[model samples]
Target: MSTDTTTEPEDASLEDLLARVDDLETRLADLEATPDDSQKMVVVATKGTLDMAYPPLILASTAAAFGYDVTVFHTFWGLDILHEERSSALKLSSVGNPNVPVPNAIAALPGMDEVTTRLMRKRIAENDVATVEELVDLSIETGVDLQACQMTIDLLGYDEDDFFDGVTTGVGAASAFREMVEADVQLLV
Candidate 1:
């Protein structure tokens, strides 16, 4: 086959036209795919323990670090992250948390529950891992708002004084639920 020795014309106008079309199509597709402001994230943690305490604060902090506005609602045992004195006293129970290393000697020891709880807290500190308090601090530094359950506190005979300073507010389930519903992701960590 003989090839034609001819050059095709390059049209700058044609390229610009195609680029504009692609951009508009992409924008329309995105708008159709999901609602705007549905990117918000909410994390709720309802447990307070050496093992479970980090989720609410850690998840909220990390999410906020990623440039997403994150809110953490702490309820029930999860409220300990804000506890003034007992926050550090959060302990992992050997009775349920299988990940906790339990030596046979410690298991057989009298008052093993207390002994293990103490050991759990010590190990967490020695490892330099973030405590519930530290994670809560990070969340605060990252602009992650904290909400403690006032109902839980009142039932426990506690008050705002029970929580650490810099906490944004204490609210009930209704307020927390409203925030969660507004968020794209609602999770119980």
Candidate 2:
């Protein structure tokens, strides 16, 4: 021991490190015994024009499938996606590009948004995609929860009951924002 006196400091440092390692081992065991955190996901949809819908609800539904508690909050143009009577009226833009896959291509020509929508309505029988209405039907069948923004609904003079069946209530922006606070993942689709 006297010959290796210089190594005393190294021995003491090693002992201290070993003690800390033991403490960490206990903490790791405790954590392993605890339950996993419940994952959260929030999806927001905006823009109700042709070809712009289906983002938030689909993403939310998919996230919920992965065991994450999912919530979809619709606002502004996005709210149109959840309309019970009007959702079927939605169309896709197919202008300037003929090969693009759109529900109703004629609905988006130069300053012809409205005209395109009208044309789409006339040809609804022949148009390919099932339209937003069809998607909503399938979405509801899969147990997806859809929520429309209260502020937007009121602003647009839409009745609360007029939204899709899955929508139970309308919520203000503050409440929507609060819902995202605990979310492990939040996205604006």
TM-scores of the models, in the order given: 0.71, 0.61
Which portions of model 1 miss their true places by more than 4 Å?
A: 1-38, 100-110
Tens digits of per-residue lDDT for model 1 on 14-52?
A: 677799999999999999888565357888888887678
Give lDDT: candidate 1, residue 151.
Answer: 84
Q: Model 2, 82-165: lDDT tens per residue?
A: 887767666555565454444434535465555656666666548664556766665566555567888889888899888877
lDDT of each: 0.76, 0.71
Give candidate 1's error at residue 76 in angstroms.
1.0
* Alpha-carbon shift of residue 185 in model 1 (angstroms): 1.6
> Best by TM-score, which number?
1
* TM-score between candidate 1 and the true structure: 0.71
